[model samples]
Target: MEDLRGAFAIVTGAAQGLGYAIARAYAQEGMRLALMDVQAERLAQVADELNAQGGDALPLVVDLADAADTERAAAQALAHFGTPRVLVHNAAILINRPFSELTLADWQREVNVILQAAFLLTKAVWPLMVTAGRGSLVYVSSMSGIKGFVNESAYCTAKHGLEGFMKCMALEGRPHNIAANTITPGMYMHTPMSERNYPDELKQKWVDPMLLTPAFVFLARQDATGVTGERLNAWELSTNPPA
Candidate 1:
């Protein structure tokens, strides 16, 4: 395992689900955290819990879909930690509706949160990572980006765009030692959103979000050198990490 003690990380959508699991893993590794989410109360509670455990966690509540809000949140995190060594773009919204039924607003909202927000946040932190000459950017991608899914046109489109965007970022960041990659969680988990859409039995068969923590931790490690612009399977990497 790569040692990440004394480093700092920024995790978007960290109030719960996979984002929360990633943050907890980072905290366990002694990394300070800036947890961003739209849920103010939940974000504060998560931050407080981590801080109580002798971890440095700051909660910033902002609508990530808004470029201005994302920029401000990024500024706050940077001011608090100077330059974070890791950034995980984990915020996403899924409006599951058939293409014929989906409204323009629905498509726009999903795109803004999943693709546009990632762009804004990455842009906000890009300079810092370059200045430090090293960093890691892990995008929380999904199978929706790789294959077509019914009633998920908007989500799929945004994720596909995210993958392409990360590839471009990887090329640009290569010179700066900033690794950029996409991690696709192949199955659903017991997230609040998933719970609403999936039956209990189906959810039980799915992998737990925490099971993918190792993959995120691995990608966030400063020692993770020469790995960029690649698409990773979280389930696979969790059991068999890259050397």
Candidate 2:
């Protein structure tokens, strides 16, 4: 495997959950990091942890839903650690209400936070990737994007839209050596969100968080060249990953 030492990377929603795990994985590999989240307090602690471990890390606290906020996040990240060689759009908001009960604001907020945020971040980073001639954007989409579920209309819609956006980005970005892909993780264990919503009665279905870090490292590696527009599942890859 190629060494990621000195490579700069960005992981959105890095204050907790899968995003935190992703940051740890990258830091272990010696990647300089720019971690973004809306939770300012949590972001501080995460940064301290990474820095204590001798990883170069910068934490940005901003609401990702606003276009200007996302723009600033991208700018601040680049300013702090130079341009990121890898960008992971792992932040998402889930609305678990019945279709009939969902409001316009609920739908719009989900779309703005999930899809628009990714677009803004990608657009901000594209010029840098073009200059460097190498970059990758990974979207942490959901299985809901592929298959529907009840009471998650807004979440499903945003995730499905991400697929289409990623495909187009992959096609256009390939010429600039900027690849785009998505990862749909199975039910994750011990994330902040999971801890909040998962009940003891439903613990049987939760997937181990440790199993996810490897695939992330692999996908973001230099050897992952030409692997654009692909959607990978962590569970499927654990047993029979693509070569």
Candidate 3:
């Protein structure tokens, strides 16, 4: 893999959870980062922590459900850091409401965070990556991406669309040496979302999200020739990256 020291990265949902872990991992690699999240105070705390560790960190608060906000944040990152070596769209919200109980607003909120923001962010980065001749794109996906679940129609639909989007981008990215891929945690994680939604059985099996950051660090160094289009399992790749 190429050296990522001083390289740029953009990570969404970076205030906490897997996104936080990924940002920490990238900082360890000596990468500069733009950390985007909806939680302003928490996001600022995260940036301060990384910055104190001798990392260059920028915090951008954004409500990704709003297109204009999403576009503005993406523009800010690009304006500040130029083209990023990797862009990780890790932000998503899962509200478990039965189809009967779901409101259109709730549906839109979940879908927009997972799918719409992915598009706007990727679209913003596409030209820069193409001009730079290489970049990596990672969309955090889950089992919902490929399978249906009760009380997760909106979340599932968005995840499903995210994976499909990655595939198409991967194909388009090939000639430019850009890589686009989706990754599943492949293990129950001890994140706020999982804490709220996990069954007792799965919570017992949950691992720290930090344990999965190795997979993301690996993804950050990729170009189309290394990996693209596949749905990767973080547990497997983090433990044993391919030679």
Quick one: best TM-score, which candidate? Answer: 3
Model 2 stretches with alpha carbons more than 4 Å out: 199-201, 222-224, 238-243
TM-scores, all candidates, are 0.95, 0.93, 0.99
List per-prediction Cα lDDT, in the order shown: 0.88, 0.84, 0.96
In candidate 1, stretches whose alpha carbon ends up further than 4 angstroms from where it belongs are: 199-201, 222-224
**Residue 227 in candidate 2 has what lDDT?**
75
In the predicted model 1, the residue pairs found to clash are none
Q: Compared with the true structure, what per-residue lDDT tens digits does model 2 show for residues 46-152? A: 99999999999999998888899889989999988877789999998887889999999899888888999989999988899888888888998988788788988
Which lDDT value does model 2 have at 40? 96
Better of 1 and 3 by lDDT: 3
lDDT of 3 by residue, 2-114 (tens): 78999999999999999999999999999999999999999999999999999999999999999999999999999999999999999999989999999999999999999
Q: lDDT winner between 2 and 3, please give it.
A: 3
Better of 2 and 3 by TM-score: 3
Candidate 1 — worst ten consecutive residues by lDDT sum? 218-227
Better of 1 and 2 by TM-score: 1
What C-alpha lDDT does candidate 2 achieve relative to the native structure? 0.84
Model 1, 1-243: lDDT tens digits are 667988989999999989999999999999999999999999999999999999999999999888899899999999998888889999898998889999998998899989998898888888989888999988899988788899999999999998999899888888889999999986667787787777778877877789888888888874236678899888888878777
